[model samples]
Target chain A: MAQARQEDNATDAPPEALRAEGIVKRFGALTALSGVDLHLRKGEVLGLIGDNGAGKSTLIKTITGFHRPDEGQMYVDGEPVSLRSVAQARALGIETVFQDLALISELSVYHNMFLNSELTLKPFPLLDNRKMKERTKQYIDDMGVNIPSIDTQVGRLSGGQRQAIAVARSVYSNAKILLLDEPLAAMGAKEGAMILDLVQKLKNEGQVSIILIAHNYSHVFEVCDRVNLLQHGRISYDKPTSESSVEELTELVVAEYRKARTTS
Target chain B: MAKQAVGGDVGASESARSSPGLGSRVAELLLRQREASIFFVAIALAVYFQSSNSAFLSSGNIRSLSEFTYATAIISGGLVMLLICGEIDLSVGQAYGFAPIAMYLADQTLVLPVAVIVGLLATAVIGLINGVATVYLRVPSFIATLGMFFFLGGVNVILTDGFPKTAPSGSFLTEILGGADWSGIAWCLLIVLLMHILLNRTRWGLHTFATGGNPVGASEAGVKTAKIKVGNFMLCSALGGFAGVLDALRIGSIDPLAGGPNIMFFAVSAAVIGGTALAGGTGTIIGAFLGTVVLSIMQNGFSLQGVSAYTFNVILGIAILTAMTLNVYVGSLRRSGRV
Candidate 1:
């Protein structure tokens, strides 16, 4: 596996799996991402903290190829690239867990896991359902997630379970960079802890880099090796977990909030 | 370790508790219909008609109704996919009648099978246009298809000189296309069955549903919405054309004016009655089949009972309106998490 990744790493992100530098986006008069620069290192969980309109979503969307920036560039590794669409972003091993989780409610867990990347067999080119079910089960167990059945529809699962399933999908797809938008916001503490542990597990694997967007500073602090504060469509502060305390980050967030309020 | 064991036990029991019994499963298949209520109504109508008049369920009668249903339902299966994905194809009726008419014209002047293939291909091209206009050009499906309907309807009249040309009787290929056997069930039902499996079991089926459920989500998740919609448009139109040819063959004549405006409504009504929604995102192939069955049965029932043909339309309108109302209410309950 390591050797295979090394070969593929010719296109692999260097040190940082994903990077967005000088991103600028405008919607008529309002700017969504203004010269924001951020990068995620391999195997580290980087938290992005911001308010509702803090350009966090826009930045992530830009990085994931949902919205192209008006001016600026994005890099997957050290090599610069232009993401015209989400498919291009996915091809570069970037996967996103949207706030809505992008789950097809009526489909079973196994079916949802392979919605876009379906497992196919020869002759008829039909879906390989049995393999998908088995693979889904293995993934859940490998991640240490407890679910009753792989056949259960995502709609029926708890919020935490759904979040875990989404994260697991990215992991199973061999994603090198994961962008999770508020994955633990709706869950209780037990669920939150489970997700945190999963984050740690990914970090230990040393094959994945993550940019987790959250309003919960404590949760961010618990998991992230580095933290980036987004404000007014730009990165206002970037620091390692060891170098900066939560109190300093909180002050930075508040100061940015106040700045935006005054300017508006 | 003890705590973990207890948790595991609880999880197992939870699965057991929620697991439905065989009876309930059967009930779900029968009564708790996802959208197949329309088909049930068709069956009920058939039963009612048959009970009142022995001839109503006779092989001949069954065969005739099925042939009619086959052509209508095939076009409908494609429309269901379109409607599910938040698009409409108003040109299907005109396209339906015209494709076969083109084939007949070709058959009389040109070769035999070539005519049929040409008709199907022409319809597919129209479908391609509909798909491209709607998906790429960003024209709303209703306006685009409606415009196509006008254009095609005019084109058909011009080509036929206002009268449809007829193919020779007992042509081997036409006979098979319109063939009905021992029980009067048209061979077209086989096509419908094949379509059912394609729409329900394949990756294309999954993508179709996903596109309908949430196109934006589906697209972000890697589904090519444009390609799916366009491909669906061609499939729907092609089926319409195919149905038109089969209908002409079954009846032993081609009528440019026959199966006109009323055909699309029949297809849409069957689709809605089966459980597909105007809002898109929720429908099943079984539901569509059931809806077609219901309409057919109702028509059979009223006719066998010697009811006025005028009253049949009124009765159908009422039935459809009632079913759709119930469908909407049930859908709301599901959405609100009350179901």
Candidate 2:
């Protein structure tokens, strides 16, 4: 938060890791996101806070290529990019950990981590079981968290453990930008702290630009360098965490929620 | 706790072991009611007839039953995969008709292997067209395959002039496809066995489940779900085409009208009975095989035991309905947190 305030004072331009310019999205008669601009720098955690229906999901979807924005452009590492599909976004080193977790419950930890992207031995097409299992174990060890086993089915995993796996999966993809949609929404205080620690760990590693989206301003304020508040499909306030309090962000979100409710 | 103790003795290592076991149990219950019920009923009647007539298990009757299983299982295998991906191919019956007729025509009019290749290519093309239309063109597989059905059926009628046409008698190719071994299993059963492995053990097999489980989720995981669906549709039709060729050889004649009807019903029946969901996800190739065997055994037993042939239809209908109901109920339980 201190560093974010310093950066804000030094420059008002977009950060280098990720950027969006005049992002606009519409669904039939409704505008989901309108003329929104945001950016993230390497190793910086950006908290995206918005009321329900304030286009948080739409913005994430558009960035992740699940839904393309009707107007505006997104850039990764200062290069123009068009995300036609989720696969394209992933290939572009932009990994999104959806709130649903999107994990296959029946598969083992390693299998779910890799999913369709299983490492296969060419010429025979047999999966490199040893490599995948070993890599999965290494990731578990690297994360330094409590996981039962690499062979554990995701369904049997606790919610916190499942979230850990989702994080591990995105990190394993070697993503330059990690978009986490409410990673701690359904988690307990302990789990939320563990995730915050993990986010901090990743930040310390300085590997990627992480975007944390949550309605919980407390958690957001704990992890983010900069916070952006959305109201009526536009960025209402964008400032460093040092300059904003949890109460201010909560008031903004609640006000926007009331306004949207009355308008609808 | 006692149940847990008993479960341990019963080989329960998984705490959620109950879920998988319950899934298979539900599958078994549905399996018993659908394709297997008729067989069970037929077995009961067969025992009665054997006790009374003493000629119910005759080799002729056994051979006839086995033959029915051969034809039904191969087609059902492909259909089950299609069902798992939430698609259908109404044109398979016609594909069945066309493949053999085309093969016969190719051999007699063109050449041997070349004609066979041509017939297969034609079938593959039909599959390709269906895949493209369904995946890229974004049409529901039901409507697209239904359109293919009418088109292929019409083509069959026009090509064969509305009657059965005999292929040149005594071709070695025909013998291999139509002829049976001492075990009474056709050579095609080997192909079916290979398909079983391909569906159960391979990566594509898992991909089929993934594509069906949630197409959006699968795509997000980079599964190329559309391509997978297209490939599955093509694979189903290819198998149908192959089955058609074998049917021609077995009958020693090709009927333009041979395959245009009842294939969707039979294949879907076999699939549903085999524990494949019409809603997609969770299925087995062996179940499909067993399903066909059960259905055929019932029909054969009815004919052998001198039961009314009309009764077989009623029994088949009841069996299918029972399987479907069981499947629906168990599926609902799974969704409702009972399983």
Candidate 3:
């Protein structure tokens, strides 16, 4: 795996997996994202931090093709493309793990993993359950996602497990650019650590570029290679994680909060 | 990773150590499957009825029971699928009433095959209307199909002038459809088998589950939930109409008032009793067939015992309520993995 990653890096691969320039999204009279610029480098984890209503979700949706940006340019693997739907974005190897995880609770773990992209028996429309179950088990083992059984309903799993399954699904789908929207929200310490470890594992694999939208600064500092802060509908701060601290990030956000109080 | 390994090890050891008793294992199996419990109940009912009345298991009575079971089984086969996908067609019975009349009118001018096709198409149109109103126009299926129920019921009466029409007879197609004593049951079994495979083995079935379980999540996963639901509605109505035509051929007549709201109630009741959730996302076509069997047996058994017709309705009402209550409890157990 290490040799393959090295060979990939040595090849003429794009430096950046995804890049957005001057992205603007408007909802009626309100501008959710205005002149937003962001980039995720190849095989890098980029932490995106923002206050509530800071257009983090809007920006992520626009990138995922869930929402059309009124004005912007997006490049995947250094090639300019226009995405009109989530399906289009997925076709381009861009997958989003939404905050809700987008899993049918009533479905089994393997079924949830292969949702909308099911494997079928050749010459028949029947689901190839045996193949899917085997693949699902392998993927879960690869990601170190601990679940009692692949046949267990997704609703029976914990929040952290569900989150890991969602991430694993995106990874297994051959996602080149993954955007995780608040993956650790509402999770306990153990659960949050599990997701953090998964992210760290993905970072170590060095296969996919990830943009993790998070509120926790320490988590961002832990797994992210670089950090970007969204404020006033644009990236206001960008720095390598090595040069940044949780205190520095907190102070910047707090200062903005103080400024907002004074103005309002 | 180490923690996960330890957890797995602990789980394995715990299961190895327990080696649950046979009685507990059987309990676990039954508790885990709503279908199994219902199956045992149906068997027990059969045994009790056979012991009480010698005529209960006779060929003649069994044939009558099958006649009752076929309609419910076929109708609930489609209704259960629709319910699993979070939709319902309360007007299925109306479609059932409408199809035979449509087929009879078409037979006057067209060939038998063409007439049958026209009948099925007429019901498919009803389904399409229900699908469009519920999915595209954003009307709740309950209200939309309820309107269809009254409208189609009125149309059936107006078309037949509130009189029963004599059914066409002596054709091989008609004989195979439902004219033979065992033909209706055969068709019902075939439909149930096909529906069961469609639900368990097909992508469309999985998509239906996903759509009903979580529409937003299903859509996010790229499943066209609207299309799945609309397709289910169409299937439900078509099945209802097919069951109606079968009944018409068997009885050799078509009644404008036959298979009205009562048939819809019985079909939905059978589906629910068979373990199909009204809340959606979970169901079994085989279970629905068994549910129809249980209901038909009960109705047949009671009449064989010389029970009053009025008392049969009261008993059916209680049975439905009891089955539904049990279903909810069983569903909770399944979700919690207690079984």
Candidate 4:
């Protein structure tokens, strides 16, 4: 079935933004991921759903180069690549917004926006704060993210605002493939809505391909173009969102729980 | 619930925009700036001392006051940076004690300039060891540096045989480094200024802040947090050594017991009183300089007033407690945006 899908992908479809084939990861006596295959198409949002400890985080970490799979062939833009570090992955325009959002709260919004990739003055080894602040303000405003001021410390901003800034930082850095891990996990309805709006806007632009890892089936259906269910370290179900429903996804997950109950 | 959260954020920002009364504004400014409040306290103490003892502000007394302030100021400047980057060197004072002895021993075999370099290199190596132990060996820096403190203290006594040694005489280097009346303060101000620039304007400083603010986050963003931390430890120890050499040059003697835990405590206290958080991620070199000034003023003022040494310690303890309490209170006020 996976081979047939790959043939279909090769014949007629949008180009693959990223593809992982036969990925396997092991830790000591435990196997976290065993022969997992996943594909993300260009400019599409793929919702990745899995139960806790189903190797969801491990897979994301592997793809982001925070982990090295024992066996895998990963391709970026149809070109095979071996990623050794997060910096190398970033060099290839792949960015991950982890669950914690990876923001330094003591730093100002502009500073956080340009944290590691700071702009420096040409003549001196000094940060160009003025230019960075100005550009951050313009970029944030253009994205329609409501921040009090660019100079405010990120810790002072609301969670939703902080998440927006994280997403914006990734987008601003020209990420071609953005992976968001639980972007709306603990967010309120309004804040979740805000993030959904931002994702929808990015989807409309169709420039950055995204893989959103979420637990809520409704959230997955809201913005995802396709859904991939990870179970027992494999993609158990892959279908377009238009061809699937929340009830179907829930039943698939519940059936696993029922099987475990009977076997135990 | 969501509406309340959003409304709360908007309300806080809105209140920040709306002006309060003039009195509250000034109060707010002082509360927001740990340095400004401490500077005022330093000035107030100076004024009181001058009024009580007419000789307090005399040129002779001023020179002595600066002599006391320079060593602490220079050491605290480095401590501020270290603390901001989420590390500390309890052995800095030992580095201070060790450098002059190293310089003195090296002066017998090498040029004075070469000997000074050797002295600084010795301290830098000590810093490197501290960094290595903390970063790679996974030792907590507090315990690592404390162990270094005791280790170096013993090394200092062994090196000097528990006796003071006279610094090399009549070199022009001494005159410029610390022998001249104003040279110590000159070096102090210059170092403080450079440290201020390094902390506020440079990319290294920004990375240092980021590394301390959130180590995991900073590393995820590709910031070399381990390098930044190790580099800060080296810089702190180097500065401590520099201050020790300067004092030895000025006094023409190196005491094995001098610049030990007392000086280290003073430097740490000054940095904290100046607004450097012990939890790290925030600090100011200029604030640390002002903090040194406050400490120096209290010590000088009490001595001029004929206060006993024991009584001065009592006052110093009380003063630290008061300053820190006020710092915490003011910090909360600033966070809540209520002065």
Top DockQ prediction, candidate number: 3
**Candidate 1 docking class:** acceptable
- lDDT tens digits, residues A1-264, model 4? 434644677689659999999999999988999989999998889999999999999999999998999998999999998889998899999999998998998889999999888999988878899999999998898788899999898888888999999999999999999999999989999999999989988988888999999999999999998999999888989998878999999999999999999999
User: Highest lDDT among the candidates is held by which one?
Assistant: 3
| Deviation of model 3 at B248, angstroms | 0.5
Q: Estimate, for each residue in B1-339, the C-alpha lDDT of model 3 and write its tens digit.
A: 999999999999899659988988888877777689789989999999999998999999999999999987999999998999888999999999999999999999999989998999999999999999999999999999999999999999999999999998899999999998899999999999898889989999999999999999999989999999889998999999999999999999999998988889999998998888899999889888898999899989998899988998999899889988887887788777665
Extract clashing residue pairs from model 2: B93-B259
Better of 1 and 2 by TM-score: 1
DockQ versus reference, model 2: 0.29
DockQ preference between candidates 3 and 4, better one:
3
Docking band of candidate 3 = medium
Candidate 4 TM-score on chain B: 0.93
lDDT of 2 by residue, A1-264 (tens): 556656674787545888899999999999999898998877789999887888999999888899988999898888999789887888888999888787766456887787777787778676676788999999988987789888766766788898999898999889889999999998999988988999988988889889999878888889888899877788889998878998887776677668869999
Residues B1-339 of candidate 2: C-alpha lDDT, one tens digit per residue:
999888787775465565667768865654444435434544565676567655657887667767777766777888878777777777877788778767877877787668777777778778888889988998888899889999998899888778888765476765776643322255446856777777654577667777776676666777777877888878888788877777666677788888676865777787787778877866667677777776776777677667787899899999889877877876666544344
Error of 3 at B96 (Å): 0.8
List candidate 2 stretches off by more than 4 Å.
A1-15, A22-34, A66-74, A78-85, A104-110, A127-163, A185-201, A254-264, B1-61, B180-186, B332-339
lDDT of each: 0.81, 0.78, 0.92, 0.91
The residue ranges of model 1 lying beyond 4 angstroms of the native Cα positions read: A1-14, A24-32, A69-73, A186-191, A258-264, B1-27, B31-43, B179-186, B332-339
TM-score between model 1 and native: 0.88
Q: Least accurate stretch of 10 residues (summed lDDT) in model 4 chain B?
A: B330-339
In candidate 3, residue A30 scores what lDDT? 96
Model 3, span A158-185: residue lDDT tens: 9999999999999999999999999999
